[model samples]
Target: MRFTLFISAILLLGCTPKDTIAIERQLILSADFSHYDNFFPIQTLNLIKKGIKDKIHIMYVCFDPGIDGEKEFPGEDYMDDFSFKIMKDGKYQPTFDKSALVIGNDFKEYFKEDFDSYKKLKAEGNISRFIEMPEKPEWWQYDQTPKNSKGKPMTFICQIDMGRIIINDDCRLFVFYDQDDRMVKYVYQRT
Candidate 1:
């Protein structure tokens, strides 16, 4: 299983867009899953990036790793929900035809100011990105990953939490990816 997973990872990396590979290579993830939490950790973000970007489609994952009644073990990497919606006519509207509500951006304009891009991170005069590994120790690869939009390849980029009051608690991660920037800007919500 590990070998299959590793080969899949290699192929996935080989398939990613060149530009998405050059994004925020360095980031600090702080999850509320811990106690006495004061955002103070410099762990690398590439592990999560490589795992999801390579294996899964360049899209968003509304994931919460510690949701109750699901995982048999705490801190186990589990993604059972990928719900997504849009704000149309000043009210939340569903844009999905299925359970996986994938929201994708064009090849360019990933860092644009509009909410169409998850870079809507700059609120309250600040920008924040969060990612944290479960006590599971590693995120090798995802099973049953999603497919890209418009039958085009995409690259996973960054993550955003719409409900950011506290991370890894009740917040569903907003993972984004793209097919522009030479590839797609993909984000997988791994909270």
Candidate 2:
């Protein structure tokens, strides 16, 4: 009877619900482009450029502009989500249709002064030429390794697209490559 009770108690203890802790192992950078000189760093840009050169896939995450305050937009089933794209045969191909992911109005308003230039570039389709140029190291701030929510040290690479004036402050796109250098994750932060 004692042996059976002990075994039963052991089994019960083993079956007890385990405390689960969520740990974020991935590195994340919170970049505020408005103060580009302070947050954007040079080394990170170089790393990202290298990743792009290596043909790593890019993932873009953004909130649905039509949605408001955590409320789902009519006919929308999923929250603002990540969009993955890959370069195949020198062409960028998105995994899903991205007709809904338009630039936010706030960004357009904030960059109103540069709107005409941006429009011209868009019409010319020569935006890549500007981004492909070698970035001046002096233009960026220093690299910063900050602790994430999980207390893990992460490389935080932040950049502001001053030239493009494309995205709003609430919307952020993070670009990084995996160990294989075959995948680039572009995480968009929606306020």
| Highest-lDDT candidate | 2
Q: Write the per-residue lDDT of candidate 2 for residues 1-191, one digit (tens) a residue.
A: 74565345334323211211111112122121121111121111223323334322222233334534233322222333222233443223333333333446664444443444444554664342222121221223332222333545432232224334344334433443333323333334433
| Model 2 CA lDDT for position 67 | 39
| Candidate 1: tens digits of C-alpha lDDT, residues 1-191 | 74565345434433322322222211211121112111112112233444432222222233222334233222322343332222221111212222221223441232122232233342332333233212221322342233444654333333334345332333333233332221222223343
* TM-score against truth, every candidate: 0.25, 0.33
User: What are the lDDT scores of the predictions, listed in order?
Assistant: 0.29, 0.32
Return the TM-score for candidate 1, rounded to 2 decimals.
0.25
List ranges where model 1 is wrong by over 4 Å: 1-94, 97-123, 129-144, 149-153, 160-164, 167-174, 178-191
Positional deviation of 93 in candidate 1, in angstroms? 8.0
Where does candidate 2 have its weakest 10-residue lDDT segment? 16-25
